[model samples]
Target: MMAIFQPFFNIISETGRVVQFFFQMLDVWKRKSISRDLMFEQIWKVTVQSSATTALAGFFVGAIMTVQFTMEMKDFGALGYLGGLSTSGTIREVGPLLIAFMLAGKVGAFTSAELGTMRVTEQIDAIRCLGADPIQELVLPRFIAIVISSFFLLGLGLLLSIFGGMLLGKYFSGVNYEEYLRHIPTIVSLPSILSGLFKCFVFAVVLAVICTHRGYSTTGGAKGVGRSVVQTAVSTMVAIVIADWATSLLADIALKIFLRSR
Candidate 1:
């Protein structure tokens, strides 16, 4: 029992070290100078590379939501509300959640595997020997990239998902395109957009930091890298779900307080 507990304690300690490293890197912005290149790479990997997956997920989610909601609305003679319902639900919840999940599978795993490989192969050591900061050279670039890419991808995903929902609503629920478009403004307000963007940004940061930390802390060789990759992806997905719920809850509370003050 003591032996088992000892391993758990070590794991916890290592995890704490990883978290500290992430915060320390963020503090000095050590890689600020190379941020642009890293941003571009991250944009390409997290945003462009994951486009197809995000789009497919968004389309399916939108289509399914529209279908189910339309059926229910039709039964209740509220089919006219399909446009507003679809837009509100997708923008407020589904869009960010789905996109984050997709990115976790794609970008998150890739980041961990790449960094883990570098660590195991001694490339990271070589950089350190040259007096280069590994966090600045690797982690910082990927961090900025993911954050920027997440915002753009989430925005694109929202638009595409909303459009997909609208198409289904128009076809199956008999909603007119013009009317749906006009009603969308009512459901998806500025606040909703801001909320979605904010969630995306948070998700990006969390995903990048966790994945990079996992990679950097990896030991052993091939097996270790593989484990880190899987762990990073799994941890990122769990973190995103938790973060999403927390953000929504906080946003709701703030909105309520602001409205009362107004």
Candidate 2:
């Protein structure tokens, strides 16, 4: 029975190691050898390269949500509120959740595979032998890049998702640009926007921890690297869902408190 839960135990252990690695790297930031170059490279690799996928998915998700919601509202002759409804859904739930899922598959897997290979080849060990901190030189740059890029990606994705819904409303639902967007202010307030961004930041941290931990701990050479990649994807996706739910719950409670005060 312990064997059945072994992987879960390993995950917990990895999470701890990743946390420790983060703090150790944090202490080394004043060192000259800490490479800003690597961070930029990772930005290009993790964020810029993945932008197309995020935007495309956002557009389609928004359009589909608009279509579905508009159709349903039309049944009761209240379709005029379609823009507000769709945008609220996109920003509050679909946009953050969907973008995180896509990024987990793209960026998360790449991180794990790359780091896992380095571990298996003993390249990480070689760097350590030279009195270098591999986690600072290696993991920190990727970690920073992932978090910053995820922030930008999630925001852009929300915009694209709203744009997609607007387009659908304009061409198919006869909403026109102005009418389609008129309700945005009413439905999506400051707290609502902040909540979505909060979800994104939390997801970024979760993704970084899971991917790096799995990658750095990889075993068994080529096969282990492959396993780490799969584990990164699965664990990240699962974490994203859980983080999304938790953040959403918190947002709801906060919103309620604010409303009561007002």
Candidate 3:
């Protein structure tokens, strides 16, 4: 009884904390309490660290979706539509969600672990004792970097998914490039593209906040760092899935509205 409600209360408390932290970050940014060098360096580090995994995940996601569609469309003698359908589905939904999951495991875990380590080592405290704001110097840069890097990487993954589907279609499904790409412009609309990008941005923010919050709040030394990493992964993945579902619902509604207006 209490155990069940306890988790709910914990979730609510944690969410409030995350929101407060985000507002603190925004306030810091408004004050220009940011380190340009730290921010750029962190961005470059996260981007480089996550790019390879993102590419591999994105490409394989597109390829796998193509294969599934190929298997289905083949039964109906509809292989020619493989590219457009696969690419459309990947770009509009599968690509962003899967790629974000990958990012959560890779980028989210790493960031949380790194920050947790720093906290456990008293490095954050050392900075604070020196009359420096740790959030501005440490967390802010990471928060901004993760968001930017994630958004860029997610977009890149979506783009690569197109080529991946195209290649798989050619080699595996015997669908030529021309036929595979033919219906994309018609099937994949402006709203679909916008929805995917919007999801990416939302995912980026969620990942950054969850990771940083878990790490920044870590205690109890090394063990706590491990716990923080695990919690961060779970929280980020859950957040990403919820965001995906919400965005998908909103996208559908907006698409209907746009079509009706047209």
Best by TM-score: 3
For all candidates in order, the CA lDDT equals 0.80, 0.85, 0.86
lDDT of 3 by residue, 1-262 (tens): 8997998999999999999988987888888668789999999998898888888888888899889999999989989888778877877888678767877898789889988999999998999999998888888899888878877887778778878888999999999989988988878889988887888788888888889888988999999999999999999999999999899999899999999999
Prediction-by-prediction clash tally? 0, 0, 0
**Runs with alpha carbons beyond 4 Å of true place in candidate 2:** 1-34
Q: RMSD for each model, in Å, please?
A: 2.3, 2.3, 1.6
Which residues of candidate 1, in runs, are more than 4 Å off? Answer: 1-15, 30-32
Q: Candidate 1 lDDT, tens digit per residue, 199-232?
A: 8777788888888898888898999999998888
Compute the lDDT for candidate 3. 0.86
Cα lDDT of model 2 by residue, 1-262, tens digit:
9999998898788667867866665676556455888888898888787899999998888899889988788788766788888888887778778878878989899989999999999999999999888888788788888888987898778788888989998887878888788888897788877887888788888898789878988999999999999988988998888888899899999999999999
Ranking by TM-score: 3, 1, 2
Q: Which candidate achieves the best lDDT against the true structure?
A: 3
Sliding window of 10 residues with minimal summed lDDT for model 1? 30-39
All candidates: TM-score: 0.91, 0.90, 0.94
Error of 2 at 163 (Å): 2.3
